[model samples]
Target: MHLSLGFSPCPNDTFIFDAMVNNKIDTKGLTFDTQLEDVETLNRWALEGKLPITKLSFAVYLKVKEQYDLLNSGSALGRGCGPLLIAKRDIPRDEIKDLTIAIPGENTTANLLFSIAFPEAKKKKIMVFSDIENAVLNGEADAGVIIHENRFTYQLKGLVKLMDMGEFWEETTGSPIPLGGIFIRKDVPADVRAKVDTLIHESLQHAYRHYPQLSDYVKSHAQEMDEQVMRQHIDLYVNDFSLDLGTEGKAAVTSLMEAAQKLRN
Candidate 1:
């Protein structure tokens, strides 16, 4: 069966999905008609339940939980690998409430974490993840929450780190930061979902064993990123958690959902 899959064009995602979509491994008769978008766009797609399989921010998953089931594989969850809040210059953390912030998306886990960290931050402008660094440098936004390769390049762009939201989450909850995960439509057959999960796990394992196979694919999607930066991005985001979200990872995702519910209440 053919299924529609949506994911970010970031290195980690392309690395995880390259083998499966390119037919490097057996997909159990399943073919993915894939769409690569930024994390925020994928979050918006999740809200509409548009794709049968897609990557979504863990926070966005909570809002559309009834429409999608979180798959155990292809997740970006680990320590020292969360979104960073950056500013053109160091701003007092306490003063962030009055400053307008640039977020990747309203539903992104970055924004959700920012909210949990600073509920007083009511002034926000949503921009594409890649545009946020420039937005801050150009004074379009006072601060920005950046994910993916931005964490590595922000300093070069003269951005100062205001906070590491992932570290804050770990310090508070004692669990790995739950960033994003692959989700499947709940309406798909249980067996098909299982196949997809297994296929994704296999794809990740294949990529790890043969990392060179995905290098080309990763570079093609990454913009203005050198080979080293792209490799760094993949290494940081993909790991044992990407292959399968075990006990700690699952608990982290559950915690995020529960916390989001409290925010709503």
Candidate 2:
């Protein structure tokens, strides 16, 4: 059977899915028609129920939980791995609300976390995740909430972090930051979902077994990212949580969802 799958072109995602989608591991008669896009695009697609399986921000998951069930594997959750609020120069926390901040996406977990942090920060401009850092530097925005690989390179670009949203979340909730996860449509057969879940686990293990060696698949989609940055991206976003959102992982995700709901209310 074939299923439509959506995920980002980020190293962490490509690293986890390389084997399963490339047939390096046994898929148990399952084949995936992959759609590689940014997490925000995937999130929008998830809202539309456009793919049978896709990776989406945990913030987006809150809105589409009724239509999708998160798969056990292929999640991006870990401590010290949350989005960063960055600016070209030092910015006072008290002044955050008054600044025009650039956000990756309105539905992104980055924006959600930022909103939770600065509920009064009403001035926000939405842009692609990859462009946020540049936007801040170019004066298009006073600051920006950056995610994915940007966390590693922002400092080098002379951008100072106004806040680490992940750190704030950890301090406030005492849980790992839930970034993104693989979600399967609830309409998929239960048995098939289980198989897909197991296949994803196997796929991640396959990638892990070949660790320290960057695969062409991962490198190809990373655009012009340096090898070190790519490795940092994978190391930060992919971990035990990616293999499965075990108890602690699930709790973190639940905390994030609950927090988002409260913010909404």
Candidate 3:
């Protein structure tokens, strides 16, 4: 049977999905019709439950848990891998609340972390993730919350990190921050979901063994194609948690969901 799968073009995603999508490993006779889009777009798509499988931020997952169940594998979860809030110039802590901030998306985990860290920061603008750094540099925004490769390249662009939201999470919760995860539609058969979950786990394993071969695919889609940054992205995101969330990972997600629900209330 064929399934529709959606994920971002980021290096970690490409690296995780390379093997399964490319037939490098056994797929259990399952075929995936893949769609690549930004995480927020994928998140919005999840609202409609259009794609059978897709990648979405933990914040988005909180909004659509009724329609989808997260798979254990292919998750971007770690301590240092959380989003960064940056400014073109160093903004004093007291002035941060007054600064106009740009966010990658309303439903992004970055935005959630930002809100949790600075709930008083009222003004927020949504823009494409790739454009956030330039938006701040061009003076369109006083600061921007950046995720993905921007975490590595922001300082190089003369932007200073006002806060590492991930660090805040680690300090407050003492658990790895769960950024994003893969989700399958609830309507999909239980066995099928298990198969897809296993496929993703195996696919990740295959990519690790054949890491070099996946570089071209990763570089082609990465926002910043620096080899060091790409490798850093992969190394930071794809970990034992990517293979399976295990105990700590699941607790992180639960904590995140509780926090997100509180934000809505």
What's the TM-score of every candidate structure?
0.97, 0.99, 0.97
Candidate 3 backbone collisions, by pair = none
RMSD per model, one decimal: 1.1, 0.7, 1.2
Candidate 1: deviation at residue 166, Å?
A: 0.8
Off by over 4 Å in 2: none
Task: Write the number of the candidate with greater TM-score, choosing between 1 and 2.
Answer: 2
**Over the stretch 1-265, how does candidate 3's per-residue lDDT look in tens digits?**
9999999999899999988998878899899999999999999999999899999999998779999999999999988989989997777888888989999999999999999888899999999998999999998999999998888888888999998999999999999999999999999999999999999999899888876555567778874477888888898888999999999999999999999888889
The most accurate candidate by TM-score is: 2
C-alpha RMSD between model 3 and the true structure: 1.2
For candidate 1, write residues 86-179 as lDDT tens digits: 9988889899999999999999999999999999999999998989999999999999999989999999987899999999998998889999
Question: lDDT score of model 2?
Answer: 0.93
Instruction: Work out how many backbone clashes candidate 1 has.
Output: 0
Q: Say which candidate scores most in lDDT.
A: 2
- Backbone clash total for model 3 is 0
lDDT of 3: 0.91
